[model samples]
Every structure is written in structure tokens, then in C-alpha cells.
Target chain A: MILNGVEIRDSFAEAFPMVGTRLIITADTAKWAMIAAKTVTGFATSVIGCGCEGGVEREIPESETPDGRPGVSVLFFTMDLKGLQTVVPNRIGQCVLTSPTSACYAGMEGGAKVSIGKALRYFGDGWQIAKNVDGRRIWRVPVMEGEFVCDHDTGSVSGVGGGNILILGASRAETLAAAEVAVEAMQKVEGCILPFPGGIVRSGSKVGSRYKGMFASSNNAYCPTLRAQTETKLTPEVASVQEIVIDGVSFEAVSACTRAGIEALVALGRDKGVVAIDAGNYGGNLGPFHFKLREIMA
Target chain B: MSGFVLTPRRAFETRVDLAGVLPGVDLSGLTVGYGDRGVALAELFEIGGSVGDRLTLKSGSALLDRVGAGLSSGELVVEGDVGDHLGQSAAGGSITVSGSAGAYAAAELSGGRIEIAGDVGERLGAARDGSRRGMSGGVVVVGGSAGPRAAERLRGGVIVVKGDAAEGAATDLIAGTLAVGGALKGKAGRGMKRGTLLLRSADGLAPGFGDALEHDLVMLRVLARRSPDLAAFLGGAFKVRRFAGDLNAGGKGEALVVPAA
Candidate 1:
């Protein structure tokens, strides 16, 4: 399939199962809320090394939040339920508890719960107070700034990770620009995150490597430097390749985000140094969720 | 599902215990103990309706005590004034009392909701005999005034009094929230241990409370969000003067007094 003369590959983007949780961090002002949110979502770009993948889902107005303050919603994804349990509390305690005038609450409910405030109440020593609000327990830990309130626990749901879009451009600059616009488009879609630096990955990899100790290595087929030496998938005209990786709470979110990224590139036009739009797959062995490019665009 | 339309047979000489008569009584299965004798409920009241999770009682001259005591689940509607121990030990379900309720209303309740359209007597949502923790779970919304010792020994849950509260309100509170819309009698929050008492009058705060500071607490916002009845009472004023108190009890509890507009 082609849109504005850009090739839309017929293959699908593969995604694996994960456990996800959503949390809301509210503060006296938008600045402090963002500070706490960025701190908690920091260093969490990939399950490959960071142990979790997360990003700011959206900014909530004071009228919409539970605490009548500016808030930001964040979504975190881990490869296993146990990982979610360990990461949620550790990140919240280290980031939110330390931020001034910040309070955390569960963004969603009804699933496996991980301790967010139930575990952090220890910081209060013996003065931590627990109150039941609309059937949900919330803990208020006394702090220098009066108090830091948080929900007892947060619920987790099944998620999908590793949904990607491969952008091949005629030059390095062109490839990076296209990937940048694609990432921006994906960020607009809720429940999904492009978990890479600047939301773009240049060193896209395949499962396993020649080195016995390494689990994954670079995709030689898409590399411009090795185009002639290796079994190249790119034509001679293609000079650079970049990928936009996405992790989402559901299959529909992943598909919607993929469609948005592809539409953005199509809108950018092929004359802008674009070559092709494709996806990475491991022979459909790694993940259960599959999003075919043509079908998603259709 | 049809519910029971219960009407008292005759004005009795003494009070009647109407506890545990919810969620599962039929036309023939209904029974109540009056003083010394076991009276068949069908013989006393006109019990007619499809049996379901609803129970409606129409009272007469006789006072009905413990109307919804120990109610675990279902819906209950009381038509007239009820005696003491209303909804005592209630775990789940909703109870709506159209008229006034006697002392110890909702005492020792663990879960569910109790809404009273009229005034409530003393010890509202307080602990019963032998139990240290009282009203551990659930919400109690009183449309009118509340008597003394409201929310005494409360372990958890929310209690909102739309009108004035008598003396000793929130006394001996063990964590919970008591928001009074009108004037609070003296000595409120005495011996409190980790609890919040919101008073609209801002008077009657004891000397034990120190460190009085004015600020908008996030918990108040949450309370206003969860209970519309409270939000209406709080109006637009979000600022509150917080007095950390009951110093004799370690000084952890707080009394948030809303200033006059």
C-alpha cells in the first residue's frame, strides 16, 4: 500500500504481553506536578534494561483531579506482575515522596494491586494516618510541607509492548526528521508510549546475536553501513533507517498509535526524502499481538 | 423484585427489636421478638410484596429499635422515628431513614451507607459495648443536627453532619473524618488520635490543640468530591484553619475550622 508515494509495508508489528499500571501525581501547581511525574517516569524507557517502560499519559486540569490541583497521569509497563510490584512502590517512594506538595493516586481500579502508599507509610514512622475515601483507603504521611497523601495501592492490567514503525529515509537527517514527527504523533495517542530516547531508536535490533553472551544485536539488514556487505533489505538509494517503538496498555491502543504515526509520515509526503515504512517481527514467535501496516492504515 | 410494605399491627406497651430482619424475609418467614414473646411478623403487620433485597417499615406508636442492625446487604427504607441501635454492625447495603433516629445510630457499623433525612440522637456512628473500634467502614450522612459524642471512637469511614453538633463531637476519635456544617459544641476532638474534625463555626476548639495554621488540605478536596452533601455545605470557601490537637493524646489529630465568608 502507498500513500503520497511512501511504501507502506505489508508485514505486521509484533508486541508482547506486559503488566501495566496508571498513576496520577498532583501538586500545588502544574510545575511541581510535572516535576514529580518526570522524576517517577525517568530512567524507565525500556524493559530491556530499565526494567520498565513508562511515560506521561496526559496532563489533567484541577477540576478533573481528585485533589483539586493540577495533575499528570503516568503509565508504567513491566514484563511481569512481580516486576510491576517492585517498580511501582520504589519509583513512587523515591520520586513522589521527595517532591514537595505532591500526592499520588491510582488512575484506574480493579486488577492486581501493587502497594503505592501502603508500603510508603513506613516513612511516617508512627504518625501515618489512613482514611477510607469512597471505599478506597488513602494514607496521609506527615511531611515538612504539612502532608503527602497517596492511595494505598494501584491496580494493574495486561499490556502490549514492542509495537514499532521502521522509517527508512534517503539520508540520516531525513530519517531522523521523519522519526521525530512519527514520535510526536504517537505521543498524542493515549495509553501508548514510544519508550526510546527522543522517542526514536536508530540501533534497531534483532533477537539474539553472534556473541554468545548477548541476547540481542543490531539489525544488519537495515544498516546503511553494511547495506552492500550483508543481505540488505534496503535499496541502494536508502541511506539511513530509524524505528519508533511503542508500548501500550491494549492492542487497540497500539494499533491506533501505529496508524497515527504512519498517517503523520504520509502527511509529510515522500518528496521530503522518505523511502519506506515497515515493521520488525521475529517470525511471529515473540508476541501475540500483530498489527499489519496496510490493515492499520486502511 | 418487590419489597415488604411493613406496618405495625397495634401500639405496643414496650419497644420492639427489629434487628436482622432484612434481605431474606418472606410473607410467612417474618418474625420479631416483642418484650417476652416471639411474635409472628405476618400477624402484626401487613407484609405484602415480592420478597427481594428491599425492606420498608411503617412505624406506629411503638418504638422500633435496631431497625437495620447487622444488615450485611440490601436496601432498607424506614418511614417513621426509629429507636436506638439503628444499623448497628451494618456491613453492607444502604439504609434510608425518613424520620429522626435514636441514640447510637449506626454504632459499630463496618461497611455500607446510612442516610438520615432527619436529626440523629447522641453517639452517632460510635462504638457499641465491648468494641473499641466503631464504624470502621462506610459513610453516614445526616441531613439535620446530630447529638453529643458524634463519631466517638471512629476507626474509619466518613460522617457528615449538615447542621449543628452537640457537645463532645468527635471525642475519642481514632482516625476518621467528621465534617459539621454548623456550630460545634465545646471540647470537640478531645483525646483524638489521628483524625480530622471540620467545623464551620470555628469555635469551641480546646486548648490542647496548638500550631493553628490556615491552608487548603487536599483531603478536604477529596471529601468534597466523594460526598456531594458535604460540598454543598462547605460552599466555595476552601481555606481552613488547621489546629493540630488533643496534645494529651500525642497531638496528631487535626481540627480544620472553616472561616466565615
Candidate 2:
């Protein structure tokens, strides 16, 4: 299927089931909230190396937050439930609690409930006071700037990760620009995230590895230098490839984001050497819902 | 009986547990469903009340725990006395008791108003067991004296006791206001962080509180006008002796002792 002269790859984007949590981190201002959120979501591009994948979901106004502060909602995902429990509190305590004038709250209401504040209350050193308002428990810890209120527990649920599309461009600059636009467009869609560094990944990986110690290795199929040596599928004009990975709360959310990112990239076509939009799939055997690039674009 | 009236059919001496009776149970149309000795609400109180403007529970000594727990809207009036927790977490409504009430009346109340014409037992407006915060919002007015530990660890809300308050009143209050018309001999405003506690008595002040300043705060007028029973203590205007601390407790709360000049 050709969408706006860009060839839609017939392959589907493979994904895996993972447990996820949404957190609302608030600060005195929107800028600080973004800083905390970005820090918490940093190094969390994939469960392969970082053990979690997280991204800024949205920005919330002060009136919308529980503590009346400007906040940002972030989605964090892990390969399993136990992995989620390990990654969430560590990141929140290190990134959010250490931030100035910041408070953390649970975005998900009732799911696989785990207590973050109940565990982190030890940081207050006998000064943390628990407040239960309207049945929701919040812990107020004495901080240098008066108090910091955080929800006792947050909810976690199963989500999908590794829903991705690759932009193959003739030059590195063209590939980076198209990837940036795709990231911006995908970020606007709710419940989905581009978890890579600056929402673009140049070193996309495959399922298996050549070394005995490694479980997975890089995707050599899209490597520009190996185009002539290997069973290359890239066209003659394609020189560089940039990948965008998405983690979403559901299959529909990921599909919607994929469609949006592809549409945005296609709109800014081939000025520098943009050739086609292709997807990475594990032979349609990994995930439950197979999102074919051609079918999704059509 | 303009509104709903709940009248017990027969007098009950033994405690008839009513903990889960009024949970999401509407009291629009007032009437007794069923009643007997040592029986629960299902056996005694008939469910016939329609959603209305007000609900009146005709007085008796039979009711036990949780009479009106989690009531969201409308009005509830007890013609006589009530059991414990008369209006626990009542979101939006007014509950008036003509006689005394048992322990934990209006515990953890969020919004609305509760007025008891008679005395109240211990732990009125205190937090439930194992819960941290207590009575985040609402206004509670007690006409007679109140028992010990009244408004303990209250986060936010207003509580006014017209008669003398028992020991440990307004202990560990985080926010909101508490006004007592009669004398308070016990440790008042102990470990308060940020709140206003007004004592309209000549019995002097608690040792835990230190004198802050002497001024006539006009906010008392606004608070008094909200409840007529509380308004009587203002008496047009009076000198408010302000005291700060529970210095023992970070020295944040202000205790105003109103002296008659």
C-alpha cells in the first residue's frame, strides 16, 4: 500500500506484554515538572538494557493536580510485574523525590496496587504524616519548603511495548529530521510513547545475538553499510535508517500512534533522501495483535 | 414531618447494631420499617424513605454504631440522642441531634454540617482506627459540653463546642478552626501545626500555648454567623487573646482566648 507515494511495508510491528504504571509528578512550575519527568524517564528506552520503558504522557495544569501544582503524567513499563515493582520506586525516589519542590502521585486508580509512599515514608525519618482524604491515602513528608505530599500507592496494568516503524533516508541528516517530526507527532497522541532517546533510535536491535553472552543483537538488515553484503531489502537510494519505538496502554493506542507518526513523516517526504516507511516484525508470531504497516496506513 | 421521619416502633435497651443500615440507604421518606429487641436494622427499620429535602430520625436509646455513615446529600435530624459516628464522612448535608451523642460523632466528615444540641462522648470528630487523616472538611457544632480528645488530628474543617470542652481538645490539629465557649481545663491545642483555636472563657490558657498577640479578629464574626449557637459567644465583639504554639510542636498554631471585658 502506497500512502502519499511512501511505500507501506507489509510487515507488522512486533510487541510484547508488559506491566505499566502512570505517575503524576508535580513541581512548583511546569518547567520543573518536565525536568523531573524527563529525568525519571531517562535511560528507560527499552527493557533490553534499561529494564523499563518510560516517557512523558502529558502535561497537566495546577488545578488538575491533587496538590494544586503543575505536573506531568509519565508512563513506565517493564517486562513483568516483578520487574515493574523494582524499576518504579527506584526511579521515583532517585529522580522525583530528589527534585526541588516536587511531589509524586499515582495516575492509575485501581489495578495491580503497590504502595510507593508507604515504602518511601522511611525517608522522612519519623516525620512523615499520613493523610487520608476522601478515602485516598496521601503521605505528607516535611521538606525544606514546608511539605511534600505523595500518594501511598499507584496502580499497574499490562501494556504493549516495542511497536515501532523505521524511516530509511539517503543521508543521516534527512533521517534525523524525519525522525524528529515523527516523534513530535507521536508524542501528541495520548496513551502512547516514543521511548527512545529524543524519541529516535538509530541502533535498532533484533531478537537473537551472535555472541554467547548476549541474548539479542543489532538489526543488521537495515544497516546501510551491509546493504550489499547481506540479504538487503533497502532500496539503492536508502543510506541511513532511524527507528521509532512506541509503548502504549493498549493495542489500539499503539496503532493510532503508529499511524500518526507515519503520516507526519510521509508529509515531510524525500527532500533529503527519504525513501520509505517500514516496520520491524518477528514474523507475526510475537504479539497478539499484528499491526501491518500497509493495513494501518490504508 | 415535612421531610422524611424515621421513628422506631418499640423502645430498645440493648445495643441494636446499625453499622451498615444507612450506607447508601436513602432517608427521603421517614418511617420505621421494622423494630424489635436486640435486632439489627433489617429486622427493625423498614426501607420506605424516598429521596427528599430532609430526613428526621425520631429519638430513641436503641441505636448503636454508624447511624448515618457516608451520607452524601440532604438533611438528617435526630429528634433525640444518637449512637456513635452520627455523620461519618457526610459529603453534603446537615445532621442535627436534639440530645446527646455517643463517641466518634461525625468522624472523618468531609463536607456539610452537624449540630448536636446535647453533649458528645469521647473522640468526637477524630480519625477512624488505622486511618491517618481525620475530618478533612465540614463544620460541626455541639451545643453542650464535649468529651475528651475532641477534634484530634483534624486536617481541615471547623468544630465549635458551645459548652465546656473536655481534656485534650484540638490535639494535633493540622488546619481548620475550633471554638469553645465554656472553660477548657485540659491540655488544649496540644501539638497544633496550623489552625485557629478560640476559647471563650475566663479559665485562662493551657501551659503548652504561648501568648502571641492581643487583637480582635473579624474572621470570628464570619465563622459565628455560620452557626447561631456559635454566634452567641462573639457578643457583638470581644478582645481575642492570641497564643501561639504548641511551641512543643513547631510553634505554628494560634489559640485565641476570648476574655469578657
Candidate 3:
């Protein structure tokens, strides 16, 4: 099936179950909030490398924030509950606590709660104080600027990760541009994140590797360099490819954002050098939900 | 008007321990249904007025200890002075005392409103002597002066004292607002963070609060409107001296002293 003259790949995007927590970090101004958020989400591109995947979910207005300050909501994902417990406090302590005039709170209130502030309160030594207002517990830790008011615990829930799409183009620059556009679109969608660097993955992986110890290898089927020697599926016009990976609280959220992103990038295919938009999958066997590219685009 | 009212049948010389009587008792379920001593509530207090949405105790001086402990909802009004632990762990509801009350007036109250028109003993809105969490949430308004440690380890909630407050008011307060209209004799907001302690006079600002700033805050205007009792001290147009420290605890909290006009 073709969407806007670009072929819709029949293959589905695979995803895995994970745990996620949302943190609302606020500061004196939006700049500091963004700075702290960026740091907290830094190096958190994938669980394979960073043990977590996190990104800025949205910019919250002061009225919606806990402390009536400009803040940003961030979504952090980990492969397991224990990983989440470790990654949340460490990142918040190192990044948010170190930022000036910043306060961190749990965006999710109900469900199973994890104590990020309860653990980080040690940074305040014996000076930490607990405050409970309107049924919400917050910790007041003394910082250089004043006090950092953070929620004692943050709530965590099961989420989905590893949803991905590959953008094929005639040139490396064209593929990168298409991927950037897709990332920009996905960033606007709620409850979903493109955790890769600049939201683009250059080295797409396959199920297994030929190396004795490696669990996965590169996706040689779509490699422009190996097209002459391997069983290549890429058209002769396709010279470069980039992938966009999404992590979301639910399969529907990830699929919806992925669809929007793929459609937006596919619309750019009418231009020169743009080839097609496809998704990466492990033969529809690894994940629970199979998001068919044609069905999603249609 | 909607609560439980216990009017004593006869004046007794012996002090009656009313502790553990009001636990899990809501306004509708409370009744002086008549029994002997330690039997039903009717035997202790005369069954006169109809049980409404609130429980009102009239002309009782023999009552002592845990008068309104662990009350979840509704109102409990005591016409006479009550003993210790007036409204302990009162999750939700209002408990008003026309007369004075003993120590731990509203200790560890999670939610609700407690008002004492008369004076209260020490530890007015504090934790249960040794607990970490004090009045977690709710509002406790004292028309008269409060004893020492008015809001110790208070996690969240507002404690407003219309009259002068004693020493060690708001010590180790984690978060919440404490407003004192009269002069504070002792340390205020010691080791406090992420909470606001507003005092009418400069006496309440401890040595920990460093710099002072003079400015008009719009939020103060809103706060005054919500609490008219606070309006007497924070009312009209006034310049506020802001102290930023408790620097010992990272100095994050603010102590706003209403400058004399």
C-alpha cells in the first residue's frame, strides 16, 4: 500500500514491556527547568547503553506545577523495576539537585510509588524535612539557592519501549533530514519519546550477531554498502537510512506517535532523493503488539 | 449543627477519661444511647439535644485525655475546656473548643480543620511527642496564644495564631504555612525548608534568616483574602521584609516579617 506515493511497509514495529516514571522538575524560570530536565534525560537514549530511556515529555505551566513554577515533565523508562529505582534517584540527585533554584516532584501520583526523594534526602544530611500538603508528601532539602522541595516518592507503571521506524533516502543528508522531521513531529505527541540521539539511529540492529559473544548485529538487509554482496531489500536509489526509536507508557501511545511521525516524514518523500518510510521488526515475534506500517499510515 | 452533642446529666467530682471514646466515630453514629459508667455514652452524659451533623459536648470538665482522637469526618465542638490530645489524628473534620485545651491539641492531624477559641498547652500542632510527621495536612486556627513548639515537624498544613506565640514555634517544619499575629518570643522556623512562616513583627525572624528584602507580594494579597484573621496583621497595604535563610538548612525558606507601619 502507498501513502502519499510512498510505499507503506507491511512489516510491524516491535516493542518490549518496561517500567516508567514521570518527574516534574521546576525551577525559578523555564530556562533552568529545561536545563535540569535536559541533564536528567541526558545519556538516557536506550536501556542497552544507559540502562534507561528518558526524554522531555512536555513543558508544564506554572499553575499545573506543584510549586507554582515553570517546569518540564520528563518520562524515564527502565528495563526492570529495580533498574528504574536506581536510575531515577541517581539522575535526579546528580542533575536536578545540582541545578540552582530547582525542585523535583512526581508527575504520577497514584499506583505503585518509588522513593526517589526519600533516597536522595541523604544529600541534605540531617537537615532534610518532610512536608505533607493536601495528601502529597514533599521533602525539603537544603540547597545552595534555598531549599529544593521534591516529592518523597514518584509513581511507576508498566510501559512500552523499542518502537522504531526506518527512513530510507537516496542520500545520507536526505535521510537525516527526513528523520529529523519525524523526530520533531514525534516530540509534539504526548506520552511518547524518541530517545535516540537527535531522535535518529544510524546503526539499526538485527536479531542476532555472528560474533561469539554479541547478541545482536547490524541490519545488513537495508545497508547501502552491503547491497551488492548481501540479500538487499533496498532499492538502487536508496543510499542511506536512519531509524527513529520511540518509548511510551502504552503500546497505543507509542503506535499513535509513531504513526504521526512516519506520516509526517513520508509526506516529505515527494521531494527529490527521498525514497520510502519503513519500520524495524523481529519477524513479528519479539513484541506483544505488531504495528503494521500500512495499517498505521492508512 | 450537624455533629454529636454530649450534655452531662450531673456534675461529677471525678475526672472522666474520655480517651478512645471518639475513635472511628463519625457525627451520625455518635449517640448518648444510655448506660452505666464505662457502659454506653448515655450514662456518662445526659441525653438532651438531638444528634445532628456534629458532636457537641456541653458543660463537661471531668473529661480528660484523647477527647477527639482519630476522628475522620464531621465536627466535634466542646463548650468547655478539654483535656490533652483534643483532636489527635483527626483525618477530616472540624473540632472547635470554646474553652481552653490541654497539650497536643491537634497532633498528627492528616486532614480537616481545628479551631480553639481559647489558649492551648504546649505542642499545639506538633507530632505525637516522638513521631516524625506532625500535622500532615489541614488548618488549625488558635484565637488565643499557643504554647511552645506550636508546629513542630509539621509536614503540611496551616497553623494561624491570632495572639502571641511562645518559643520554638515551627521548629523543623518541612512544609506548610505558619502565621502568627503577635510577637513570637522564641525561635521561629528553625531548620525549616520549603515552607512560609509569616509574622506580624520582626521578633519572629530567627537569626538564621539572613538578607531582608522589601517588596509587595501579590500572593500575600490572595492569602489575606482567604484568611481574614491573617488580614489583621497582613491586612491593608504594607511593606514586607523578606528573610531568605535558615541558611543553616540551606536557607531555602522565607520568613516574611510585616514591617511596622
Candidate 4:
């Protein structure tokens, strides 16, 4: 089916389960809060290499924060609960604890929990103080500028990761523009984060590589340069493609984010360099969750 | 008014013990001490209303002792002044006294909440002779000042006093937190081993304390946000001058006093 000259593929995006946690980082100003959020989420675009996938969920206003300071909400996803428990503290301890005038807290509530402060409290040596406030244990470790207070543990959620939507267009510039528009729209959805560089992946991967010991490699099938030699999914007119991957607190959140991007692109239609909308799937075999393109657009 | 209301038949000749007699039941078979003689509860106060979650005392006297002691569940309300050992050794549930409480109020309390609208006498929330802890868990909110030796040997829980505390507040605190919104009179924290005494005035601190720099404490802000009712005692402080002390008693305690206006 097509909408305004763009094809709506029958394909679906395959996603799998993940353990995720959300942390709220606050600072005297919004700039530092965002900085800490970016730092902790840095190098965390994929679990295969980075061991986690994390991104800024949103910015919190002063009135809502624990200290009445400006804050940023960030989400991190790992392949398992144990992995999440490891990566979150390392990031917060190194990045946030060192950030001046900043404090971290458990942003999400309920479900299972992982201790972020238990691993970092040793930084205080024998000076750290542990107390309970509103039933959640908090650890306060004195720092040079002041004190670094954080929840002893934050709640972890069973989430969905690897949800994707591919923006295929006739030229490189148009394809990038289309992906940009989709990213802008998808960011509005709650409980989801785009964990890629600029929320778009240029070198999208298939399942595995021909080289020994490599688990994943580039998607040659969707590459414009390999259109002639490989089993290319791209049409002769299609010149470039961009992948927008999503990781969220729930399957429904990923689906909503995907639908938001599709809605935004479909509204812009052919005028924004006409092409088609497709999704990534491993023949619907690997992951348990599937987001069908046509069904979603319908 | 809906729950059990026990009003005295007349002024007590001697202090009476009213422990373990809870609500949600009839007091017909329940026998309690009236002075040295055992008397039926009906022989004392005029019983009114059916059994319910709350047990309200229409009036109180210095003769009423061990009020709501060993209360495991349900609410107990006292409308007037009560004698010593008010809510003593209660494990759970909530006890609220609308009037002043005598000495040993909530002494050896392990769990549950106690709220007093007026002054509490000396040795408030203090442990008895042999026990290692007093007011071990739960919260106590005193709307008015406290007498000397408040929170003695307190191993756990929180106590917030809205007005000045007399001498010896937190004298032998073991652990947990006690925050006083008003000035602390005379020397305090004499034998504090491990705990925090958050107060507004530091003028009365003992020589056992040594000045630690005025520093920002995020825990105060966090506590203020978590429990707003106790925020007044924390002085809504972003920074406080810490006195690391009771050094004569092993030094793990602190008296965090908010800067003077």
C-alpha cells in the first residue's frame, strides 16, 4: 500500500527483551544536568559493543526534581538485569558523581531494583552516610564542591530493545532529511529513547558477518553501493537509506514511537523526496516483539 | 467519637495502667488496674460507641499510665494530658495524644507512630535500664517542645520537635535522627555514639563537639522533600555548620545546626 506516493512495506521490526532503568540527574543548572545525562549515556549506543544502550528520556523542571534543581531524565537498557546493574553505577559514579553541583536519583518506580549507590559509596571511604527517606535508602558521599546524594538503588524494568524503522529515499540528502524529521517526531513519545548517534544509524547491520568471530556486520542488502552485486532490497531509484532504532520501557512504547515517526513521514509524503517506509526484521524469527509497518500505518 | 471512648469515672486515687486493652472489641471481660485494685474497665470510664479501628480517650490524667502500650495495630487517640509511659513499647499502629505527655512517652517504642500536640516530659523516647535501644523504629512528631534527655539511647527511628528542647536532648543517642526546629537549651548530645542531631540553634552545644566546616548536605534537601512535615526541623537548609562530637563517647555522632539568621 502507498500513501501520497510512498510505499508502506508489509515488513515488521523485530525487538527483544531487555532490562532497563531510568535515572534522574539534577544540577544547579539545566546545562550541567544535560551534560551529566549525555556523559553517562555516552559510548552506550549498543549492548553488543558498549554493553548497554542509553539516552536522554527528557528534561525535568525545577519544581519536580528532588532538590528543586533542574534535571535530566535518562534511560539505560541492557541485555540482562545483571548487566544493567553493572553499567549504570559505573557511568553515574564516573560521570555524574564528578559533575559539579549534581545529584542522581532513581527516576523510575516499582518492579525490580538495582543498587547504584552500593557500588559507589566506597568513594566516600568512611565518611559516607546512609539514610532512608520516603522509604528509599539514600547514600550521601561528601565531595569537594559539596555532597553527592543518590538513591541506594533504582528500579529496573523489563523493556523492549532493537525496535526499528527504516527511512528509504531516492537520494542521500533526502534520506537523511527524512530520518531527521522522523527522529524529531519520535522523541515526543514517552518511555522510549533513540540510542543512536543523532538517533539515526547510517551503517545498519544484518545479523552476522562472513569474517570469523564477528557477530554482526553492515547490511549490504540495503546499501546503495552494493545494489548490483548483493541481494539488494533497494530499488534502482532508491539512492540512500537511514535506520531509526528505538529502545523503550515497554513493547507498546516502542510501537508508539515507531508509529509517531511513520505518521510524521507519511504526512510530509512525496514532496520530502518520495520513496517508501520499511522496518528491520530477521525473518520475524529472532526477537519476540514485532512492529508491522502496514498494520501500524493502517 | 466512633471508637471506644474511656472517660474516668472520677479523678484517679492512684495512677492506672491501661496497656494491651485495644479497640475493635468489647471491654466487658477486660480487667485493668485502678490504683492497686483490679477493676473492670466499665467500672472506670463510661463506654460509648461500638468497637472500631480507633480507641479515643475523652480525657486524660497524670494518673493514666502506659496508655496504648504494646499496641500492635489500630489507632489510639488521647484527648488530654497523660501520665508517664504513654504509648510505651508499642510495636505498630498510630498513637496520637492531643495534649501533653508525661515522662517516658514512647519509651522503648519499637515501631508505629506517635504524635503529641503538646509538650512531652523528660526522658521522652528513652530506653529503660537494661535495654540497648529505645524508640527503635517508626516516627514521633511532637508539635511542641520537649524536656531534658529526649531521645535517650534511641537506636532507630525519627523524632522531630517543633519547639525548643530542654537540656540533654539526644544525650545518649545510639542511632537514628532527631531534629529540633527550635533552640537546644544547655549542653546536649553528651553520650551520642552514632546518630544525627539536626537543630536550628547550636549555641548550647557541649564542649565535646568540634567544629566541622559549614558544608552543603544534600541529604537534608532529600529528607525535606521526602517528609515535608520534618522539613521545619531541617530548617530548609542548603548548608549547615556540622559539629562532629560527643567525642568523649567514641565520636560517630553529629550535630548539624543551620546557620543563624
DockQ of each: 0.54, 0.10, 0.17, 0.56
lDDT of 2 at B173: 81
Q: Backbone clashes in each candidate structure, one number apiece?
A: 0, 8, 15, 0
List TM-scores for all candidates, in order. Answer: 0.91, 0.70, 0.74, 0.94
Which stretches in model 1 have alpha-carbon errors above 4 Å?
A: A207-217, B59-62
What are the per-residue Cα lDDT tens digits for candidate 4 across B165-201? 8998888788878888788887888888878888777
* Model 3 per-residue lDDT tens digits across residues A185-217: 888888887877887889988877888877668
* DockQ result, candidate 4: 0.56
Cα RMSD of predicted structure 1: 2.7
Candidate 3, position A168, lDDT:
81
State chain A's TM-score for model 1. 0.96
- Writing each residue's lDDT as its tens digit, candidate 3 over B69-176 gives 877876777887887787898888778888888888889888888888888888888988568978877888888999888888877788888888888888887767
Between candidates 2 and 4, which one is better according to DockQ? 4
In terms of docking quality, model 2 is incorrect
Q: What fraction of correct interface contacts does each candidate retain? A: 0.63, 0.00, 0.14, 0.54
Candidate 4 per-residue C-alpha lDDT over A1-298 given as tens digits, one digit per residue, 9 for 90 to 100: 8998888888999999999999999998999999999999999989989999999988999889987789999999999998988888899999999998889998888878877788889999877877764456788887887779888888989999999998889899999988998999999898999999989989899888999988889899999999888998998778999999999999889999999999888887877885988889999888999999888878
Docking class of 4: medium
